[model samples]
Target: MVTPENVSSYIQQGLECEYIDVDGDGRHFEAVIVSKAFEGKGMLQQHQLVYRALGDRMEQIHALSMKTFTPEQWANQA
Candidate 1:
Protein backbone atom coordinates (compact mmCIF):
# COMPACT_ATOMS: atom_id res chain seq x y z
CA MET A 1 0.00 0.00 0.00
CA VAL A 2 1.15 3.50 -0.78
CA THR A 3 1.84 5.71 2.22
CA PRO A 4 0.73 9.29 2.70
CA GLU A 5 4.38 10.28 2.59
CA ASN A 6 4.60 8.67 -0.81
CA VAL A 7 1.56 10.61 -1.97
CA SER A 8 3.07 13.84 -0.69
CA SER A 9 6.32 13.04 -2.48
CA TYR A 10 4.44 12.37 -5.69
CA ILE A 11 2.69 15.74 -5.58
CA GLN A 12 5.96 17.47 -4.84
CA GLN A 13 7.54 15.87 -7.88
CA GLY A 14 4.94 17.41 -10.17
CA LEU A 15 4.08 20.69 -8.45
CA GLU A 16 6.00 23.35 -6.60
CA CYS A 17 4.51 23.53 -3.18
CA GLU A 18 5.54 25.99 -0.51
CA TYR A 19 4.26 23.74 2.23
CA ILE A 20 2.43 20.45 2.21
CA ASP A 21 1.05 18.17 4.90
CA VAL A 22 -0.64 14.86 4.21
CA ASP A 23 -2.19 12.31 6.54
CA GLY A 24 -4.03 9.12 5.79
CA ASP A 25 -4.62 5.48 6.29
CA GLY A 26 -3.75 3.28 3.32
CA ARG A 27 -6.93 4.08 1.45
CA HIS A 28 -7.91 7.63 2.37
CA PHE A 29 -5.93 10.83 2.70
CA GLU A 30 -6.16 14.50 3.52
CA ALA A 31 -3.76 17.19 2.39
CA VAL A 32 -3.08 20.82 3.10
CA ILE A 33 -1.14 22.37 0.23
CA VAL A 34 0.26 25.86 -0.05
CA SER A 35 1.75 27.06 -3.31
CA LYS A 36 2.31 30.03 -5.54
CA ALA A 37 0.87 28.07 -8.46
CA PHE A 38 -2.56 28.24 -6.92
CA GLU A 39 -2.81 31.97 -7.38
CA GLY A 40 -5.62 33.04 -9.78
CA LYS A 41 -7.26 29.65 -9.69
CA GLY A 42 -10.77 28.80 -8.52
CA MET A 43 -11.50 25.90 -6.15
CA LEU A 44 -12.22 23.37 -8.91
CA GLN A 45 -9.22 24.45 -10.91
CA GLN A 46 -6.99 24.15 -7.88
CA HIS A 47 -8.27 20.64 -7.31
CA GLN A 48 -7.75 19.80 -10.97
CA LEU A 49 -4.10 20.79 -10.70
CA VAL A 50 -3.66 18.45 -7.79
CA TYR A 51 -5.52 15.71 -9.61
CA ARG A 52 -3.26 16.13 -12.60
CA ALA A 53 -0.24 15.72 -10.39
CA LEU A 54 -1.59 12.58 -8.79
CA GLY A 55 -2.33 11.04 -12.21
CA ASP A 56 -3.10 7.35 -12.16
CA ARG A 57 -2.49 6.98 -8.45
CA MET A 58 -5.74 8.86 -7.93
CA GLU A 59 -7.59 5.68 -8.72
CA GLN A 60 -5.81 3.89 -5.93
CA ILE A 61 -6.75 6.52 -3.41
CA HIS A 62 -10.24 5.85 -2.13
CA ALA A 63 -10.66 9.34 -0.73
CA LEU A 64 -8.67 12.55 -0.71
CA SER A 65 -9.62 15.73 1.07
CA MET A 66 -7.52 18.74 0.26
CA LYS A 67 -7.26 22.30 1.48
CA THR A 68 -5.35 24.19 -1.17
CA PHE A 69 -4.11 27.73 -0.79
CA THR A 70 -1.91 30.31 -2.41
CA PRO A 71 0.98 31.44 -0.22
CA GLU A 72 -0.83 34.66 0.53
CA GLN A 73 -4.13 32.93 1.18
CA TRP A 74 -2.39 30.52 3.49
CA ALA A 75 -0.68 33.31 5.37
CA ASN A 76 -3.96 35.18 5.76
CA GLN A 77 -5.56 32.10 7.29
CA ALA A 78 -3.70 32.67 10.54
Candidate 2:
Protein backbone atom coordinates (compact mmCIF):
# COMPACT_ATOMS: atom_id res chain seq x y z
CA MET A 1 0.00 0.00 0.00
CA VAL A 2 3.04 2.28 0.12
CA THR A 3 3.12 4.37 -3.01
CA PRO A 4 6.09 6.34 -4.35
CA GLU A 5 4.30 9.59 -3.62
CA ASN A 6 3.91 8.58 0.02
CA VAL A 7 7.58 7.79 0.17
CA SER A 8 8.48 11.11 -1.41
CA SER A 9 6.32 12.99 1.06
CA TYR A 10 7.91 11.26 4.01
CA ILE A 11 11.39 12.31 2.90
CA GLN A 12 10.26 15.86 2.21
CA GLN A 13 8.54 16.09 5.59
CA GLY A 14 11.70 15.05 7.37
CA LEU A 15 14.32 16.76 5.25
CA GLU A 16 14.56 20.19 3.66
CA CYS A 17 15.01 19.14 0.08
CA GLU A 18 15.67 21.28 -2.94
CA TYR A 19 14.48 18.44 -5.15
CA ILE A 20 13.43 14.86 -4.63
CA ASP A 21 12.11 12.11 -6.84
CA VAL A 22 11.07 8.65 -5.79
CA ASP A 23 9.86 5.70 -7.88
CA GLY A 24 8.84 2.29 -6.81
CA ASP A 25 6.64 -0.77 -7.12
CA GLY A 26 5.04 -1.00 -3.69
CA ARG A 27 7.81 -2.88 -1.90
CA HIS A 28 10.96 -1.43 -3.42
CA PHE A 29 11.87 2.17 -4.03
CA GLU A 30 14.55 4.37 -5.50
CA ALA A 31 15.04 8.05 -4.81
CA VAL A 32 17.21 10.92 -5.90
CA ILE A 33 17.28 13.57 -3.20
CA VAL A 34 18.91 16.98 -3.28
CA SER A 35 19.28 19.14 -0.20
CA LYS A 36 21.44 21.77 1.40
CA ALA A 37 21.75 19.49 4.43
CA PHE A 38 23.81 17.08 2.41
CA GLU A 39 26.60 19.63 1.84
CA GLY A 40 29.34 18.23 4.04
CA LYS A 41 27.95 14.81 4.79
CA GLY A 42 29.42 11.57 3.58
CA MET A 43 27.34 9.08 1.66
CA LEU A 44 26.63 6.97 4.71
CA GLN A 45 25.68 10.00 6.72
CA GLN A 46 23.42 11.27 3.98
CA HIS A 47 21.61 7.95 3.91
CA GLN A 48 21.36 7.99 7.67
CA LEU A 49 19.68 11.38 7.54
CA VAL A 50 17.12 10.06 5.11
CA TYR A 51 16.56 6.97 7.24
CA ARG A 52 16.04 9.15 10.24
CA ALA A 53 13.47 11.12 8.27
CA LEU A 54 11.59 8.00 7.31
CA GLY A 55 11.46 6.94 10.99
CA ASP A 56 8.99 4.14 11.61
CA ARG A 57 7.76 4.31 8.03
CA MET A 58 11.02 2.67 7.01
CA GLU A 59 9.63 -0.62 8.23
CA GLN A 60 7.00 -0.50 5.54
CA ILE A 61 9.58 -0.03 2.84
CA HIS A 62 11.08 -3.37 1.85
CA ALA A 63 13.95 -1.79 -0.03
CA LEU A 64 15.17 1.70 -0.75
CA SER A 65 18.00 2.90 -2.94
CA MET A 66 18.80 6.56 -3.10
CA LYS A 67 21.18 9.06 -4.59
CA THR A 68 21.68 12.00 -2.27
CA PHE A 69 23.24 15.28 -3.31
CA THR A 70 23.79 18.79 -2.09
CA PRO A 71 22.17 21.63 -4.07
CA GLU A 72 25.48 22.60 -5.67
CA GLN A 73 26.35 19.00 -6.36
CA TRP A 74 23.04 18.47 -8.10
CA ALA A 75 23.49 21.50 -10.30
CA ASN A 76 26.85 20.18 -11.49
CA GLN A 77 25.21 17.02 -12.79
CA ALA A 78 23.43 18.90 -15.55
Superposing every Cα of model 1 onto the true structure, what RMSD results? 0.6
Which residue runs does candidate 2 get wrong by more than 4 Å?
none
**Per-residue CA lDDT of candidate 2, range 1-78, in tens?**
999999999999999999999999999999999999998999999999999999999999999999999999999999
TM-score between model 2 and native: 0.98
Poorest lDDT segment (10 consecutive residues) of candidate 2: 32-41
Residue 38 lDDT, candidate 2, scale 0-100: 91
In model 1, the worst 10-residue window by lDDT is 6-15
TM-score of each: 0.96, 0.98
Q: What is the lDDT of residue 52 in candidate 1?
A: 93
Best by lDDT: 2
Judge candidate 2 at residue 51 and give its lDDT. 99
